[model samples]
Target: MSSLVASAVEYMIDAGQRSTLFLDVLRQRGDQYREHVAKTAPHVLQYAAELIVDGRDLIEPVNYALVRIVPPEGVQIDLERRPFVVVDPRAGHGPGIGGFKADSEIGVAMKAGHPCYFIGFLPEPVPGQTIERIARAEAQFIETVISLHPRADGKPCVIGNCQAGWAVMILASLRPELFGPLIIAGAPLAYWQGVHGKYPMRYTGGLLGGSWLTAMTSDLGAGKFDGAWLVQNFENQNPSNTLWTKQYNVYSNIDTEADRYLEFERWWGGHVNLNAEEIQFIVDELFIGNNLAAGKILMSDGQKVDLRNIRSPILVFCSEGDNVTPPQQALNWILDCYADVDEIRAYGQTIVYTVHQSIGHLGIFVSGGVAKKQHTEFSSNIDLIDILPPGLYEATFEAKGEATTSADLVVGDWVMRCEARTLDDIRAMGGNSPEDDRRFATAKRVSEINLATYRKYVQPWLRNALTPQMADAMRNLHPLRLQYHALSSKNPWMFLVKSAAEAIDGNRKPVSGENPFLAIQERMGKQIVQMLNSWRDAQEALSEAVFLAIYGSPALQAAVGIDPESEPARPRQMSPEHRMMLDKRVAELRSRIQEGGLREATLRALLYIGSARGMVDERSIAALRQVRRDHAAARLSLPEFKMLVREQFFMLLLDPEEALAAIPKLLPADDSQRRAAFVAMREVLAASGVVSGERAVRLRRIADLFGVEGDPQLSNVTSFDRDARASQGGENSQGLEQHHVG
Candidate 1:
C-alpha cells in the first residue's frame, strides 16, 4: 500500500512536468504565428529560395510569383534535367506549404538532381487580379523556366497541390505545349462526385442553397473575401483533428513535436485574401456548377478549357483520408470528360492516378514519407510517363518483394507498375448516381436564382453599409485570428505564460511512457476527440439530410426549371466538331498504317503487347529505354518519342489486324537486320521475367511477323549495331516533322 502511494505521487509529478512542456509548446506556436503574421512577405519554406519571376510585373499582373529553390548543402541540382515547379493552393493559407520541410516535394526533386521552382502568392491579391491572369502568369513562368534551361532533356514538370490542381488543369488545357508530365495532388476536379455517406463537403453547396452566401460574404468584406472562412470550413470538416487530436499529439510528444507543429501553424495561421471576383468564379463555375471537368469553362480570351485538350500526361494523387479532395472527386473527372478509354486514346492523352489509403489532403503533398516515396518515384519516372502510349492507367508502387522481376532496373526501393484501366475501373470507386446528379443540378439552379435575387434585393444596402475599416475589423476579430492574438505576446496576459514556459523549458522533465497519470490523460483526450468527432459526423449527416430533402423535391426542381426525371447534366461535349476531328485523325493514321521500318514496327509491337496484357511494369519500360540508348544512332526527343508512340498506338487501335500485318512490311528485308530488330524487341519483352499469358502470345505473334521463331528470353539480349532506319538511310522518320494538336 505504501509502494502504491509512492508510485501514484511519482505519476502526479511527471504529469505536472509534461503539462508544463505542452503549455510551452502552445505558447511557442502562438509566438511563431504572431511573428509569421506580422511579416510583409512571410513563408514557411524550410529551403532558402531565390526569386525568379514576379507575376505582378507581367503584362496582366497577378499576385503569384516564381522562385527557384536553392538546394541545401550536399544536395545537387542539374539544369539539364527537367525542372519541377510546385504550385501551392491558395484556398485560404499563405503559400510555401509545398516546401514546408526539407523532405518535401522541392527537397526530393532537388535531391534527384532536378532544379525546382515554387509558385507562391503574396498575402494580398493584386488589385483586379483574377484566376485567368494567374494561369497566364503560370504559363509565362514556365516559358521563363524554359528560356533559362535551353538544353533541358524534357519540359518542366508542374505539380499542383489542392486548389492549385484545378488551376493547373485549366492552364494545361489552355497551353498544353508548356507542360511536361502534370501532377495534381489531392485536388478535386469533379465537384458533385462523392460516396453516399462520405465526403460531406460535396453537399455543402446544396445545403447552403448555392453561392449567394459567398457573394454576400464578399460584399461584407468590401470586394475582398476573407480566406478565414475557407480555413474554418476545412477545420469544421474534422473537428476531432482540429480541436483536440492535433494538440494532444503535440502534447504527447512535446519534446520532438514542438518545432514541427510550430512550423505548420505558421503557414496555417497566415490567411490570405482573394478578390471577390476570383472567389465567385471558383464557387459558381467550379464548386456549385461543376463546370471544369464538363468543359463548360471558357477564359476571357474565349478559349474553352477542355480536359480532353490536355496532352501532357496527367498524374493524379489522392488519398482516402483526404476529406478535402477525396478520390471520388479527384478521379471522376475522367468519367465526366471522356466516354471511354478509346476516346482517351483518340484524343492522344495519357492519364495515370494513385490513391493512398489514409494520408490526408495536406499529407499528400507535405508528408516526408509520401515525398520520399511517391514524389521520388514520380520524379525518377517522368520520362517513362512522358512516353506512355495515350491511354488510362492506374499507377501503383510496391516495395521489393519476392515476385518483383528485374529489381536492378529500378532506381528506387519500390517498383512502380501501371495497369491499364477502363472507365469501369473508375466507376467501381463510387460516384454520384443519375438521381444524385439531378439533385445537384437542381441545387445549381437554385443557387443561380438566389444569387440573382440577392443582388437585386440585398446587395445595395449591404455594399454601402460595410466600409473597408469595418471589414478590416471583422477579419482581425475572427475566432481563428483572435486565438493567435490571445496567445501571443501582443496580449499582456500572455507574458506570464511565456515566462512560465521559458522556466519550464530550462528544466523540462517529460514523463516516462509507463506513467499511470499520463495514460489516464491520454484516455481522457481520446474520449474528448471521440465526442468532437461524433458532433462533426452528426452535423454532416444533418446537413446532407437537409440538402437532400430540400433539393430532392420534384416541385422545387420544376420551379428551378429542371426536369427531375430527365437525363442528368452530362459534360459539354462538342460532338460534331470532335467527331469530325477524330475521323480526320483516324484517316491520317490509317493512311500511314503501312509506313516506316524498325521504329514504327517496334512501337506497334509494344503497343500490341500492352493492349493484350492491359498492364505495364517498370522492367519493360527500363529495357525499352536501355535498348534505345544502346542501339539508336540518334536520340529521339520526348516530343518525337511521344508522337511516334501515339501514332503507332493509333494505327493499332484503328485496325489491329492490318497494323500487325504491316509490321512485316515495315521490317527490313535483310534477315540480319530483321534479326537484330527482333532480338532487341524480345529483350524488352523478357525484361519482366518470362512473359506468359496473353502478353506472351502477342509477343510470339510479333516475332512471327518479323520472321523469327523461338522465344529469346532476357539473357539472350543482342546489341543492335544500329537502328534499321538509321542504317537504311533514315527511312521515313514518321513523327519527326508532324505536329499534332497541342
Candidate 2:
C-alpha cells in the first residue's frame, strides 16, 4: 500500500509539473496566438462603436417596410397580408441574429411574402435607461410598424428571441393592442423552475446567495454593468466547449472552419453593457426573486407588471436540451400566473408551446435548420394561431412536400397544427416548490436590504470618486475588454503570428478518424466528459433537494408566504367598452362561419382527418374549394355562415350517427359521381374512426338510392349494421335491403 501510494504521488507530481510548464508556455504565447486568430474583435468593435454613434440606424430601414416582405433569392412567403417583426435578444450580444442568414426567422418571413421588420438595439444602452424604457421603446417600434403597414390585415406578428421574449411580453402586457400574435423563443419567465439533475443555471442564485455580487460588480464598473460578465457566466456553464472543444474543433478543421467560427464569434464577442440600476433590477426582481411571472415586479414608475394582461395569442418555443433556459422555465410561467386552463381561456389567450427534444439555447435563435422549419411554420401560420379558440396547445410542425402550396418554390414546405394540451402534462415537467419560492423571496428581501444599505453608504462615496474618463478607462481594462484590445493591431508581435498562421493554414495536416491513437484519445476524452457531467448532475440534484428541504419547510413558507401553487384571481369583469369589443368580435366570427363557414370548417376537418388516415375524397376537395370561394366573395354575410357552420360542426360532434344518416339527403344525384363522392366521404370519415364496414356500406347504399352506386360488399356486412338496423327497425331495415337488391 505504501508503494502504491508512492507511485500515485509520483504520477500526480509529474502531471502537475507538466500542466504548469504547459500553462507557462501558453501564457508566453497567448497574446500572439490570440491575435493571430482574432478576426472578430476588430469588426465587432467597429460595429459596436458604430451602433453607439448612429443609434437611430438600429431600427430597420426599408421601403414597403412593414408589408413588403423581400424573401431570400430562392425562398417564397405565401401570405402577403400578415406583418412580421423579428425582435433580436439583447442579452450580452450584438444584433442581427434573427436575420443573420437567409435561412433565418426574418428570411422565412420575407420568403413567405410577409412584410418584415427587425427590432434591434445599439450596443450601448441609452443613458439612465431601464427595462421599462426598453419595453416602451419596443411598444413604440411595434406601433410604428403597424402604422406603416395599413394594408396588412392584422397587427404585426411579433417574434422575440431569448431576452427579447420577456421584453416583448412586457410590452404586450402594457399595450396589448400593439401586437397580433406573439412568439417567444427560449425565454425563461419562471426562472426558479427547472428539471431534476438538469438545467444548473437556475440553482446559481441560491448557490451564490443571490444578487449582492451583481450589485457589487455594477458598483465596481462605476454605474455601468459590463455585459461581458454575463457573457462570461454563460461561457462558464459549458467549460469543455467554451475553453477547449470549440477552439479545438476550429483548429482541427481550420481550412473550412475559419470563416464560420469568425462569423459566429463576431456576434459572440460583441458584448454590451447595462446601467447598474438596470442590471440590479433584473437580477433582484426577475432572476433571483422569480417575481416576473408572479405579477410581483413593479417598474420604476410603480406600474405592476402583469403577464396575463396581454391579450395577444402567445407561442412559446423551448427545447429539452437547452441548459440555459430549459422547457420548464420557458413554460411554467403559464401555470404560475394563471389558475387553470379555464382562466387562460376566460382571458381569451391562445397559448401554444412547442418543445424540441435537443437544441441548445443559442440554436433556438441562430440555427438555420430550426429557423427553416420552426420559424417558417410559425410565420406562415400566424393567422391560425391568432384565430385559435382560447386554450393551451402543443404546436407540432410537419414538413409536407407535395402537399404544400407552391411546393416547388418553398424550401421548408410544411404545416403547423395546434393540438390541445392539458395542464397536468405541463406540470409533469419540473416546477417550483414552496421552499424554492421561499428561497427566491428571501433573496428578494435580502437584495432590497443590501441595495438600500449600499445606496445609503457605498454608492454615494463611489459615484463621487469616479469620473467619466476613469469610468471609461476602467471599462476598457475589463478582462474581456483587455483580451480584445491585446489581440488587435496595437500588439507588435501580432503581425508575425497572423502571417505564420496564414502560412500554416495552407499546409496544415490534422489527424484523421482512421488514426487508431487519435480515435482512442477522442473516445477517452468523451468518456471523461460524460463521467464529469454525470457527477455534476448528481451534485446539482442533491444540492437542489437540500435547498428544497431546508427552505421549503412550513416555517420558511410562513416567513416568505411563498406558495408556488397559488395564483392570483383573474378579473371576472371587463369594462363596458372591452365587453362590447368582445361582442363585436364574436359577432364578426359568427357571421364568417354562417357564410359557407361550415363548409370551410368541414374542409379543414377533412384535411386533418385525411392526413391522419392517409386518405382523401371528392367531398373534402369540394368543401375546401367552396370555402375558399366563399371567403373570396365580396357580398357574403359571415354571421349566417357562422351559425350554419356551428350547426353542422356540433351535429357531427354530438350525434355523428344521425349526421351520417342525413348525408344521403344532401347527396348529389348522379350514379357514378355520387358513388365517387360516397367513397371519398367514407375515406374521410374512416380516417376519423367515424364509420366502417356494414355501417359504411349501408350509408353508401342510401347514397345509391339517391343515384349513387352501392358497393357489393354489403352482402358481408354484419355486427354494426345489425345493431343500427335493429335500433331503427322496419322501414329503415327494408330500405337498406332494397338498396342492396340487384
Put down candidate 1 lDDT per residue, 580-603, tens digits, no spaces.
Answer: 998898898899999898888977
Candidate 2 RMSD to the real structure? 9.3
List ranges where model 2 is wrong by over 4 Å: 1-79, 299-303, 399-415, 510-513, 531-546, 549-626, 629-631, 635-742
Q: Which parts of model 1 are misplaced by more than 4 Å?
A: 571-574, 710-742
Candidate 2 lDDT, 658-707, residue by residue in tens: 44445444543454544444444444343223444344445444444434
Tell me the whole-model lDDT of each prediction, alpha carbons only: 0.83, 0.61
Model 2 quality (TM-score):
0.72
Counting clashing residue pairs in each candidate, in order, gives 0, 15
Residue 575 in candidate 1 has what lDDT?
Answer: 70
| Structural similarity to truth (TM-score) of each candidate | 0.93, 0.72
Distance (Å) between predicted and true CA of 544, model 2? 3.2
